[model samples]
Target chain A: MIEVNDLTKYYGQKRAISNVSFKVKKGEILGMLGPNAAGKTTAMRILTCYMPPTAGSATVGGYDIFDQSMQVRRITGYLPENPPLYTELTVKDYLMFVAKIKGVEKDKTKAEIDTVIEKASIGEVRNRVIGKLSKGFKQRVGLAQCLLNNPQVVILDEPTVGLDPKQIIEIRELIKNLKGDHTVILSSHILPEVEQTCERVVIISEGEVVAEDTPENLTARMKGGERVLLELEGDEKQVKEVFRTFPDVTAVKVNKTAGGLLKVEVESKKDLRKDYAQALIVKKIGLLEMQSDKVTLEDIFLHLTTKEEAA
Target chain B: MRKTLAIFEKEFKSFFYSPLAYVIIAIFTLITGYLFYNLLSWFVEQSFMMTMQAQQYRQAPPKFNVNLHLIRGYFGTLAFISLFILPTITMRLFAEEKKQGTLELLYTTPITELQVVTGKYLAGLALYIVLLIPTMFFMALLFIYGDPEFLPVLSGYIGLILLGSTFIALGLFISTLTENQIIAAIGGFALSLLLWIIGWGATFTGGTLKPVLEYLSILVHFEDFAQGVIDSTHVAYYLIFTIFGLYLSLKSIESVKWRT
Candidate 1:
């Protein structure tokens, strides 16, 4: 539902984003993973028709952002980093005003508001002033505002930035439920949050797209195929040699821990924990701890972003 | 038009919800009420003096126009008070949105800049009109007690509304230039006061310079309407001035979008 090509934006002499491009398919939840200042907000701003890109162009719902901005804005709902709210107004009044501006029909304004209020689960606080509400409620009210007009595209910029863990989980669930109905572009620095909620992830770093794929594919495609950790009472060199000689073992590293135990990290294409545990016993190397873990999005993100910085 | 009305409705209702609007209206009514009372006393004292002189000289009292003596002075004071009060009203128009980050919501909406500016301008103008309400009660007192030429008083109000529009439009433009409400209020007040008094330079200069200064002065156009004259030149001046201010506001909004 959205296509961005070489979108660049410069605030005066400082370039906020440069030649950044990405796409979101219809009814897909695409997560934009990036640290702060990674041009995520800037890209979303350009897509929402909040501001025009300095170079190149974008189209939303098959309408060009520059020439058909009204159409783009009409169909796209945006929630900026800070929830745009009037502190003095009640939640219902605020939603009613937004509906009028968003062009909800006069006859349906109240029903449309009721639907959003129910969706964001803010019905309990519907009559309460927004400023007096809790942060979680305020964030949900922001989300409720986006659901107005039933826009085909919903773009949220760091929707769960400062929320507590429970609120984050609730928000993630709400976003996950938006699948197959509304095209969502969510930007966040939290990798696990993206991994859990998004169908596809776009890893952005230094104003560039480093990787774009499913979370599973991203973790699997990075350098580490499989990883095994072993804490043992043995010579570091002997432990490394054994894992190096093991079938499908690609690389191994050993370091001494505080407890006088050798910590061995073995990266291989295949799992050999059962075989390796037996071999260690036969070699008379005492095993204190043995654990195997799959590569996570955190590992891939760090590797991709840090590698880009190094180059 | 519907979008503009939506913005206007929200803004207009917000003014009543805040204490600043009530304070401004209270202070404005008190000052104008005091001036009207004092003017009424002066008019009565002057007429009493005229009657004494006529009776002593055995002659009829000459004509004394209440519209000139009372209504004109009341309208002038209203115009002056609005210059100060309107800035505070307009100060919060765009500055508050910018300060609270609601400008992002406005920009992303499908509404155009013209609609936004027009809606805000109308809201401020409406409040300025509301500020004139108490004084209207004062004007009604004059009609109940004595005969005053109604057309002159009517023209004076038209002039006051026009002048208020000029102040509000200029102040609205200033609000768009900053996120700080204090700065917007102070900047708008200073610029408006400067324009109101810019014609004073006519006293120091001669030839073509004097006319230019007088023509540029916002107060000069309103002075004609305050005195009961409805000259088309003065009407054109105020219309042009208001449009120019609104034009600047629209241009500034556009420039902000393109402020790369």
Candidate 2:
């Protein structure tokens, strides 16, 4: 639903984002991962037509960012890092105002406001002034404003920052529920939030996209040969000698425990766990525990960003 | 126009919700009431004394004329009040939006900068009219006491409204230049005071410089307006000034990237 071509932005002498281009299809939940000052916010601003690109072009729903900004704006709902809220306004009034500005018809405005309030789960605080509400409530109100017009593309920047664990979970679930109706592009430094919520991942660093793939593919790409942590009831030397009999075993580290247990870290060129266990069974070496070490989302994110920086 | 009205309603509601609007209105009313009471009492005393002195001299008791002076004095007082009040009201229009990070919300919407500026300007002017209502009571009192010509007083109010609107426009433009509200208020007041002094400064200059200086003077245009004279040139000047200020504000808002 959105196409960007070599979009770049510069602030005076400093380049915030350079040579960035990506496309998001309809019914896709895209996650943007980046470190601090990674130009993620800058890119989102350009996409939402909040700022012009210093070079290149971007279009939302086929309308150019520079030329057809209003058309682009009509279809996009952006929630910036700090929710732009008039604290004096009550939640209901704020949503109503947003609905009007987004050009909702007067007849439908009230019903739409109520729908967003329910969608964001801000029904309780609808009558409360925003300034008096808690940070979590304020964030929900921000999300509600974005959802007011039921825009086709919903862009949320750091949607879960400064929230308690429960509130974070609630927001993540809310985003997940918006899957088919609206295309979602959410940016966050928090790895798991994006990993859990988004269908596709775009890892960015130093104003560049380093990796873009599904979360599973990204983890699988980083996963090379199989590795397993084995704790065995035997001497380290005997465990090492028995492990050597396994053909696919590539590397091993043996640690002897005080209680007659051997902890062996085994790396294999292929799936060798069954073969190693049979060898241990024949050698009478007790296999206490064997857990495969799979890389977590955090590791994938760090590896992608830090590897790009190192390169 | 619907979008403009939506913006206007929001801005107008913002005044009552925030203490700044109420404080400005209350303070303005109090000060205007004080000035009005003192001015009319002063004029009554002057006219009474002038008549008594003429009777003793056996001359036709000097025909007391508070007509022209009353209207002129009201405009003078309004100009001074506007010098301080308009900036406080306008300094927060856009500058506060930037500071509070709400400008991004407005900018990313499907509205143009023209709609935003015009809506805000109209909201401010609406409040100004609310404050002007009490002064009309001062006019009513004058009518009850003496033979007061309604046309000049009506003309004087129109001039005051235009004068206040021009100041508001200038203040709104300054407000967009920076996120600092204090700087906006100070800059707006200083520019207005300079425009007010230009007419008198023209008298100080010799031959060639005088007319050129007078043409730039807001006071020169206001004088004709205050005298019940609806000169098209003077009306055009204030109209152009207002439009020019609004245009500058639009440009300033456009230059800044709205980042939240």
Candidate 3:
């Protein structure tokens, strides 16, 4: 539904984003993961037709962002880093205004607003002035505004920033619920939130796409394979020798303690826990515990982003 | 067009949603009312003395034009009051949107920059017209107590509306330049005052420059309207000025996308 190719933007002489490119398929939830100043907001701004890019181009629903901006704007709904709201207006009034501007027909505006209000779970605060509402409620109102007119694509930048944990989870669940029906491009620095809600992610840093893949594929590619952490009560030298001699074992490190207890960390091309266990049993080496060490998305993000900086 | 009306409705309602609009209107009416009352008393006192002198000397009393004495004075005071009130009305038009981050919503919508500027400008014009409505009641007082020329009164109102709209368009343009409402208000007032007094420079200068200075002065065009004269030249001047101000506002709003 959206394609960004070699999109570059400059604010005066300073470059905000350079040659950044990514795509979102129809009905796919794509997360844009980047640290602060990674040009996440800049990219979203270009996509939403808020500003023109210095070079390259983007299209939403097959409408070029620059040449066909009106079409692009009509089909795409954006939630900026700060929710664009009028404090003086009531939630219902604000949404009604948004619906009108978004070109929702007059006959359908009220019904559409009620739909978004219910979808964003802001029904209780619909009649209250937005200024007096809590931040969470305000954020929900912002979200509800984006859902008006049944936009085909929704672009949200930092949707969960500055929210409490429970609110964050609720927002995450809400985003997860948008998976099949809407094409969503959500940008954030939070790794787990993206991991939990996004089907695919484009990890960006310093205004460039450093890595792009599914969450599981990213972590798997980061370590090359699984890692095993094992504790053994045996001769430390024998334990190390047994793991080193195993065929699929790539590397092993053993630490020997006072009571002949050995702590072993093994990295392998495949799962070797069972094979190692059999080897230890055949060798009469007493095994205390065995488990697989998981590589998280955080590690992969840091590795990729820092590697980009180093290069 | 529908989208522009939506924005217009929201902006117009926003003015009354706060105490700012009412407070400004109240202060404006009080000042104009006081000035009108004082003008009326002075006109009555002068006419009474004229009659006394005519009877004593066995001569005819001088004719007093109520439109000149009362209506002109009322409109002049209204123009001055508008210098203060119109800026306050327009200060929040774009500045508050920038301050509160609602400009993002405006920019991302399918509406063009021209529509946004026009919608906001019309809202400011509407508020200024509402502020002028009370002056009609003041005009009705003149009709009740004394006979006033209908054409002059009508011309005077047309002048006030035109002048007020010109100020509003200029104020709306100024509001787009900053996010601080105080700065917008003060800057708008300073610019309006400068334009209001620009014709003063024509008196001090000589040669070809005098006409140019006088032509640039807002008051020069408005003076004709105040005297119940609807010269096409003056009408054109205000129409051109209003369009110019709105044009600049549209350009300023479009520039925000690039500069920000």
Best by DockQ: 1
**lDDT tens string, model 1, A232-279?**
998887887778678798888888989889988888888889888998
Compared with the true structure, the alpha-carbon lDDT of candidate 3 equals 0.91
Model 3, residue A300: distance off in Å is: 1.0
The local lDDT score (0 to 100) that residue A132 gets in candidate 1 is 94
Task: Order the candidates by TM-score, highest first.
Answer: 1, 2, 3
lDDT of each residue in B1-260, candidate 1, tens digit only: 89899989989988887788899899999998998899899999998999899999999887888988878887888888888888998999999989888888888878898999999999999999899989989998999998998888889889989988888899999999999999999988998898899999999999999999999898888878888899999999888889999999999988887878
Candidate 2 lDDT over residue span A99-198, tens digit each? 8888999999989998999999999999999999999999999999998888999999999999999999999999999999999999999998988999
Sort candidate 1 into its docking category.
medium
Segments in model 2 whose C-alpha atoms lie over 4 Å from true places: A230-247, A252-264, A273-290, B258-260
Winning model by TM-score: 1
Native-referenced Cα lDDT, model 2: 0.88
Ranking according to DockQ, highest score first: 1, 3, 2
- DockQ of each candidate, alpha-carbon based: 0.72, 0.52, 0.67
| Model 2 residue-pair collision total | 0
Q: Candidate 3, residues A117-147: lDDT per residue as tens digits?
A: 9999999999999999999899999999988
